[model samples]
Target: MKLYPIESGNFKLDGGAMFGVVPKTIWNRTNPADANNQIDMAARCLLIEDGKKLILIDTGMGNKQSDKFFGYYAMWGDHSIDKSLAKYGFNRDDITDVFLTHLHFDHVGGAIQWNKDRTGYETAFKNAHFWTNDNHWEWATQPNAREKASFLTENIMPMQESGQLKFIERPQGDFKENSELGFGILFADGHTEKQMLPHLKFMGKTFVYMADLLPTAGHIPLPYVMGYDTRPLLTIDEKAKFLNAAADNNYHLILGHDAHNEIITVQHTEKGVRLKDVLTWSDVLTGY
Candidate 1:
């Protein structure tokens, strides 16, 4: 199996929202804010080449949204899924599965696109089966007030309408040892209901996709939760538990939202589990 980092694009979000109740004076040290108080964020997705099945995890916020809607987000950079795929000698058609971490726009937006006629929406990966758990599908389709804005109908319904949507086997409890997609699944609820975090062993090490549960290395601290989380107290407990296991087992966390910090490992520190090191893709590729 071969894994590649696919950068869909970059955008900015309010640092305060990203870090939650944590004051800017603290988070700003790591994730500095711009004049508008927004910080850089990456729609970085992962591509897995397992035999003939090309699986893509989390499609970034796509380009189909109107300029007025996108104005809220400071979208920047020339990086795109097309160029990123072509970089590895592949294309959208080659993807056989799109494993969504959640249905939020930034994570699942690129899964659907405007059809050629602009009459309606279509699945972005024409040949792929879009994957999500049953619980998450229900939660997203029938969203609550706090999450309604993040779960856009256009970004979601098309996959179901296209008849390409699929679900992973969800087991009772916070973590599932194995998923249909061939990765262990970690379910987090603070950010969104039944949000799945993917973990798979690769390149002689274990890698866990930290999708919002631990968005960035800066969030390694238990208290650095996001304002977007519906239950901040629950997030604190979840982070504490996950970070302990990550430190004990030496799991390498693949960050989903952090634009600059790609991958990381944590160690037991006096304060708590802290970042052991910030690593680049090349560093992980060489297994140093």
Candidate 2:
């Protein structure tokens, strides 16, 4: 099995929103905000090449939204989905599965794209089976007031409409048993209902897709939950449990939004599970 870090692009978000009640004095040390008070975030996705399947974890914000809508996020950087795929000698059609962590615009936006002549939407990965949980599919389709803005129909419905949407049934307990898709799934509800973090066992090592549950290394602390989360208190509990498991198992955590740190391992430090060592995906996977 081979894994590639596919960087779609970077965008700016309000630092305060990204780091909940965590004071700017603290988070700013790592993720500094611009004059407009927005911190830079990478729309990093993961690609897995396991035998016949080429699975993509998430698609970064696609270039389909109107300029007015995009102005709010201030998208930046040159890295794009196409460019990233080409770096590995592949393209959109090469993807066999698109495992979405959730339906948030940034996470799934690049799953669909505008058709030629710009009349309607189309699946970005013509051959991929887009995977999302049934509960999340329902929740995103009928979003609550707080999260409605993030669940854009243009970025979602097309996958189902194209007859390529699939879901993993909700797990009965804290963790699902025998739920490995060549990579295991870890469900966390604090960020959003049924956000599936993929735990990949590669080369006898475990690498986890941190997703929004741990957006960056700066979010390693239990209290650094994002304000955008629907359930902040629950997030605290979830983080404590997941981080403990990651440390205990010596898992390599791949951050979803950390622009600098791609992969990191945590240790039982004087200040909780502090980052032990930082490495890139290639460095860890290929022994570079």
In terms of TM-score, the best-performing candidate is 1
Tens digit per residue, CA lDDT, model 2, 189-229:
99898899988887788889988999988888899999999
Top lDDT hit:
1
Where does model 1 exceed 4 Å of error? none
lDDT of 1 by residue, 166-191 (tens): 98877888888754577788998888
Residue-pair clashes per prediction, in order, are 0, 0
In order, the Cα lDDT scores of the candidates are: 0.91, 0.90
Q: lDDT (0-100) at residue 22 of candidate 2?
A: 92
